[model samples]
Target: MRHLLAALFLALSTVAAAQQAPRIAVTDLAYEEQVARYFQYTRFQGKSSHRESERYADSDYSSRGSARSSGRTEIDYESISGDIVYIDRGELRKFTADIKGEMLKSGVYRVVQAKPYTAKDNEKLYDVIDRIKKGYFPNADYVLFGSITSVEPRRELNPIQGSDAISASLSMELVAEFSLIDTKTYEVKAAFSAMGEGQDMRLLKDPGQVAHLSRGKVMREVAQSLGVDVATQLEEQFNPGAARRARGDRYREETIERREERIIEYR
Candidate 1:
């Protein structure tokens, strides 16, 4: 009888604990790549300037005439202009997948899938506010909003010292900002920026050999690291005074500043 009572209490306790976990709806990471293009087009003017003249002279013996002399010139002009372009890379699923997995693994929060808000015009909605209002994340207590602040990839090739082989390296960096917002109050509970970077290098033995860098590997590494970073920060920010007292705060702040830059200005 006592065993049955204890088992009932234990089951109830487990149920209560499960219900106490915060339910979070994590949306895919939003990213927008702005591409500014400068173009120059050379147009053939199809214009020709011609000069023609004829001279005739009459002398005592006979009349002498000179034929017409003609000259032509062609001109071409160049037109240069630029345009600001925006590319909407709907949702970065790779990063979001990793982040959601990490959060789930942590067991701190109950992670839920957030659906996309399908607008009537078929335009994609990247904003969390619109998604929440449209009932994308149903029954979620809070929404985890993420956006890609910046992504940079670099490649370099240089001669190795004291060797005939060339060293080729490829590196990728990703920065994203995350915010946990209360669904009812629409207040931001925690907000922070996270970054991840990865690199790969290889030595080319043959001079004419093509060096292929493992771009996918590098990006996967970045995504994994970014996921861990986001989960760690989320946990830290939720704890009172944890983020402020953390030793990595200064470094994170500096990274956040370096990764974000304003390129467009509107008057």
Candidate 2:
């Protein structure tokens, strides 16, 4: 009977603790990739050459010859170059999902969905501040802003020093920055940068086999790593000691007050 009562009390306490956790809204991951294009157009120019010679013979005049020649040549050419920004909304969503999943799993903060921003067809970037100003995270106490800084992938092949084999490697790296800001005050509570990497390697005796690298797997891993880093940093920057104290004080005050009201109602 004592054990059962204890278990029941513990369950209620756990629920109360979860309810006290701060609610945070995560925004879409912002990223942009620039692709430069060089275009050239060539057209043939219609040109003609003409030559004329005339010789007139007179009964007793010496032979005379005259020649005229004219030529024209032209080549039409044009070059156009510019950079275009490529935004993959689906990929960015996946990356944000990974971070959100990690944050949820950590249980450091309750996750809330931020209202999606409507973007125009030609828009290439999402602004976090504008979203906040527009009340995108109305229910959240804080907004978590994230952006991808850089992504780099490298592949290389090398011959073994003492053997006829060859070694191949593919490496992928991703870096991102994150900030936690108060929803009302707009003050940045915590900010930091994190990086994730994945590598695939293989050795072949024939040296002719194609090395296959898993890009999706690498990207997923990188995203998950970034999520973990974000969550861990949030916890550390807030200071666990202060958080625990705040939780304890709130729990005591709220629970005791509720209990007193219950007793009065029963009487």
Candidate 3:
């Protein structure tokens, strides 16, 4: 009876271990910088300027003697000025600033306000991954990390009319490249590139507005790609029975023996 009880306890322990959920560490996604350029109208040079001025002249005379008295009348002149307005560069700058702010606030991707990473900064990618893993999943079975490999921006010119006259407009295209790595095997898991484009509407202005629009679009694409890749990786590493147990599936007495048999077969 003592030996039989010991064996039963051992079996229970094995079953418990097999039902434990596998831990996976998902590192922060890395992405390349994306740029978009658009022409924003800043100032209009042909607008009219106006000024107004007023003038007054007056004269008065008086007699010294009380018997004789004299009075003089005075006249004044006044003027007002007005002018029609034209488009200017200031308008373009304001519009561009508005667009840029909107894009940054959209939160489609992690936007970097500063200059992009240099070749020397490439090491930071691995460092970030390692730090995240250490903090979130010290004993995790799998760690996924990646980095931004490249970013290229190309601009094309178009022509449009401004308040002053015809001006050159710009359209920008951005390309981004990313690479995924497996921490355990030190192997590259996936690599891909994405591109997005934006057009500037203000022909007589700054190009920053359209650039932001393009960046936002690219960010959305990057996120979708990352989701698909991560899903695939998880599927590959998943253990079916562990997943079911983690999801709160109960084991039946009859199926318990079959499950044990399958686990043994897989092991």
Candidate 4:
């Protein structure tokens, strides 16, 4: 009887251990491009002039029956003018990659590399959650889905005057917003915004040129800030240490329960 009981208990314990192990499915990570509108200003110098001329002719009857004198007058004027113009042009590239990399470092969730899809294509939020759940978790405790909600460029108009020209500079600011959804619960887990600003630089010639220079710096800052948040979130969500700690607590509980059972059996 003792042998039979021990065998049965071992089998049951094995099954329980298998059930306790977490079956995690990490679906492919998805990201949407958030193109930021950029503004820039430039100055130029040009010269123009106006001229007027008059002609008069004199004829003398006695001294010059055949002689004539002619005179001409010329007037010239020139001036310089300065202009300040505002322009909205250009775009920031490779924004999605920066966001994804930062999110991966956050360690909040297991992110898999998956196919690229847009929020428009998958309109309903639930559809995205369902897709992730199917890919990462046919049976899972949690599922995470997110998309880029908005990307807007904030411009601070700056005007500067020079001796020959007036120029305007666009102080560029890039802001990106994201929304996250939970699959099983079908709830919004989090929504937040991030921003990056580029250092002010005078683009001497044109807004387009200035935009080109400032965009890189702005995007870099945005990427850095985003990465920090992503790393923090990931750590909170899927850190191995958390799982280990939970298992440790469960083991302690099991030990206490086993001890109580043994005492009862002895009695």
- Scored by TM-score, the top model is 2
The residue-by-residue lDDT of candidate 1 on 1-267, one tens digit each, is 345544555565446546666899988787776667666655657666677788899989999888776778778776766775756555677777778888878766788878764455324455567677778889898998888898899999999889899999999999998899888888898999999888889999888999889988898889889889998999888643333334344544454444443212321
lDDT of all predictions, in order shown?
0.76, 0.72, 0.40, 0.48
Q: Output the lDDT of residue 80, model 4.
A: 49
Residue 125 of candidate 1: its Cα lDDT?
Answer: 54
Clashing pairs in 1: none
Root-mean-square deviation per candidate: 16.8, 6.8, 19.5, 16.0
Candidate 3 local Cα displacement, residue 243, angstroms: 11
User: How does model 2 fare in lDDT?
Assistant: 0.72
TM-scores for every predicted model:
0.65, 0.67, 0.29, 0.39
Encode model 2's per-residue lDDT on 87-197: one tens digit a residue: 454126657787788777866678898876655632534555667777778889888887788889988898999999988888788887888888878788889887877
For model 2, the superposed segments whose C-alpha errors exceed 4 Å read 1-12, 33-35, 39-91, 121-126, 239-242, 245-267
Query: Model 3: per-residue lDDT, tens digit, 62-89?
Result: 4332233345544444444454343211
Give the residue spans of candidate 3 off by over 4 A: 1-21, 29-136, 154-214, 233-267
Lowest summed lDDT across 10 adjacent residues in model 2 is found at 82-91
> Which window of ten consecutive residues has the lowest lDDT sum in model 4?
21-30
Clashes of 2: 0
**lDDT measured at residue 148 in model 2 versus the true structure, 0 to 100:** 81
